[model samples]
Target: MRDDSTRNTIIFVVCSLALLLLYQVFILEPAAQRRQAEAARKPAAASNTTAGPVAGTLPGVAAPAQVRVVTRQEAAAASPRVTIDTPALQGSISLKGARFDDLFLKQYRETVDPNSPPVELLRPEGARHAWFAEFGWTGANVPGLPNANTLWTVTQGSTLTPTAPLSLQYVSPAGLTFTRQIAIDARFMFTVTDTVANTGAAPVSLAPYASVQRQGAPAHVGHSQIVHEGAIGWLGDELRLIKYSKWAKDGGMELPSRGGWTGITDMYWLAALIPSQSENVRGAFRVTKAGETNIFEANYVGALRQIPVGKQVTETTRFFAGAKTVPVLKGYEKQFDVPNLNWAVDWGRLRLLTQPIFSFLEFIYRHVGNFGLAILGLTVVVRLLFFPLANKQYESMTKMKKLQPQMEELRARFKEDPAKQQQEIMALYQREKVNPIAGCLPLLLQIPVFFALYKVLSVTIEMRHAPFMGWIKDLSARDPTTIWNLFGLIPWNPASTPLIGQILDTTLHLGVLPLAYGFTMWLTTAMSPPVGDPMQQRIFKLMPLLFMFIMAPFAVGLLIYWTWSNVLTILQQYVIMRRLKVDNPVDQFIARFTGKSRAA
Candidate 1:
């Protein structure tokens, strides 16, 4: 019975792994390659596709036919601008449309290298992949109300700063004066207030509108399903999200809510608009096409307001364009009553687990000042939390190991009498108070915890570029040192070699973390009861090596967590085995190393 169960478990593990490997190699990898090939096939001229219909666009506003493409420098040179120089941001506001068109995140860089250029968020309008925020008054049948080409004159400060804000004024030909005051905080929030005074003898109907538009799709979109890249928002009742591919395929979406936020989001960055929390607004996400390029837009239109003659109406809206940091998002969410803004971070379906894990990890990180140490701290916490369950599990396994010889004898004696063999095994189990399945409880409970950790390590911007100790510069990335080049001692790159090289770099890298995890896995398995079937035992012995290869490409942070967990499990099992007076490989190995007597 023991032999059959072990054989069945071995077969199951082997089949599952084989199926997963085959599916990944044939389906997922080929699909990724085809996507790369399709992206490569796009014309270089597509980057220059300045096909327009960009400006003066709202739910009902008309769009222009075409706009010329130009370099970011040339586009910036073409427009008069108000300089924005904040501690965390450096950008310029284009006066032509009063658009937030040029922005660079001063606190972040394009790469881990300190010398790399700062992260460019909003490029100029005529530039390739131009993304910017536009705000204006949409009037009904009122012509000279500051359209796209209406350039504004700066009436206030020259350089916009946290201490000093700037205001721009535009007077239409029809006796209307428009004033826009733009202010920014030390972080990423920007406040824009628009006041229009009807100087003529007649009243006008006008509504405020804000739009975040991108001329073309990002160079790479939907690279991974793990990260959400597209339109996301917190509508009145719930959060709404649409990926880029689905956003284009589904035509578009419209939602009417009292107070909410809407924007386009990438993995680590976000450009969102927060409308007046007390006003009703119509929010929309739209996609248009220019030649082969797809243009994306997310905007909201406020309710129409009646402006009396000689009187002015003011509307204020806030914008958030920066990294998806949890504390920052939560701060804004609380200060402005924005619900679930941190939901912008893809917490996945495991929010119940992932959120708490990330919070705990962040807390530990704050105390330790290193993400690697935080991960180790988390592992220890998790182990302690599950110590009682794990103790019972290891105790059951120890009892099973003590009864293994008797079970084998019963199985061999009743080889021809299967029913009798089962009966004897059950009687023996009753006599010895052994449970064969209690050992699986801890493993069964670990799946959710493991997946939650994976989500935290993968999606959070805080984990990006976080370094661990020696040779681990980025916790969010896979281990860089590969065994193929003897961990850089050979001074050869596997990537330079071609087919097998690519495989070695990705699939079979066998880095130190993965190897350490594999060793711990083997040690834990060795301390457990041996499988009765020889073939099953041999395959089980190789399972750790197989898993090492399987886990080689995951984030180094996850590998560290798992390896440390395994070490803790080993210690727990050793202690339990010592209390039970059961023989374990740890004591045997220690005995051999130190020439001491082994545990009986």
Candidate 2:
């Protein structure tokens, strides 16, 4: 009988572990792979691809035939002139109109990318149409410039057409003239420089202003979201006029509302550089006014800097227009700082820890080439590191399980007096030196790590559309194969279901993995002692079903992690049960620290 009991125990443990490992690899891992694959299939979902110049489209400037790609010096020597045509001042609309027409425009749509780091872009639908022409400079990269900085001068009457050839001419006061060629090769980055020359004798007071009216309804920004300008600031509906950061008595109010444009500062989703005094200020500023036309202006206050007549002062304004990816943005360095990366939790201390975790996950993806294996390896490392703590917990649970009969007797004896029952239980606990909550320590330690990893797996771009084995295509979405149909009547079988029929159907055929997950959780719970009163036990019995429901929609990778962790814990418990001898409370108090069994 003893041998039979041992064999049964071994069988149970092996079956449970096998189920967990299989579910993780077969179901969870594949689910994650599916999610990653779907995301990778979409071009706009890639951060690097989206940030690069939209291939095949340039606003304002027409594509040149037989494009000449040469060094900055060569392009400068061949400088071409681009003329912006201003029509008869019609109605209230400015003659500077920018139109964005490109096939790549679809890449800007809202969707999660597994390859690109996540970022928050706070503009409305105006981004849908590329800026063609406006009164202000377009904020992006300019072609043919060594550094992504250049200004275009509208020769007043020349109409800018898509087919017309354009050129850039840089005229220096020392007669150092340079010309640059431009072309459209499926993608183009044009930077608009606005240098306002102070041709007037007096110091002209100028506060550069630009606005764009929304042709459609406003976009949504959630309540939890906040716009930070060095410090946190709320993004109000109407025009939000914020002053630049300044040096104050109490250190520096990083984002303070100051008078007049004196220094450049970055606000939520926007950056601007203001000159101490405008001579010919050349820089781009994004403005959102009450009207519909979205206008971005760059102005240079030229010769307005308290300069004597005939001594011309030039303030060169530079704008960067291109992709917001790391490489392209790095070219323009300090100028292009777009806040898009989503940190797990916004708390300063937690964010520090969370960011590195995400960075590490990204690194692992590059090396190991599989996120599923990465998660498993990470879990194993964490568990091994905390083995000592886990051991302590398992020993405590073993002792408690052995004393269950004594505990039940104590409850029965004090059944009439609730206070007496509690006192007896405490006394018993003291005698046994057992801590009920000690088992919770391991779980408590793992919660934060688990949550942080969860965030990384959900948001990291590298894991998107990444493959594991088969069937599963995306890690971020629910399992595509569902087991049941409407009213749980028909089995929506993946193998038998036709492709066209499956496409129209919302239900997916349920598979074995989810069922295995549910069964393992139930068995793990069954192997443990009951807690709380009858009501709690009843609720506890429903836990496995509840967990399966909750987890059904989660990425297969997460389910794999959870299932595998449980399996390891079960094995650990089994070892503790066999090796760590627990004294029968009816017999005597055996010293648990020494592992010696004593007789009553």
Write down the lDDT of every candidate, Cα atoms only.
Answer: 0.84, 0.40
- lDDT per residue for candidate 1 within 383-435, as digits (tens), equals 88888888888988888888888998998999999899989998998898877
Candidate 2 local lDDT, 135-158, one digit each (tens): 222212222211122343333324
Question: Per-residue lDDT for 252 in model 1?
Answer: 67
lDDT of 1 at 591: 89
Model 1 weakest lDDT span, ten residues long: 55-64
The candidate that wins on lDDT is: 1
- lDDT comparing candidate 1 with the true structure: 0.84
Worst 10 residues of 2 by lDDT: 86-95
Question: Which ranges in model 1 have alpha carbons more than 4 Å from their true place?
Answer: 2-30, 59-65, 591-600
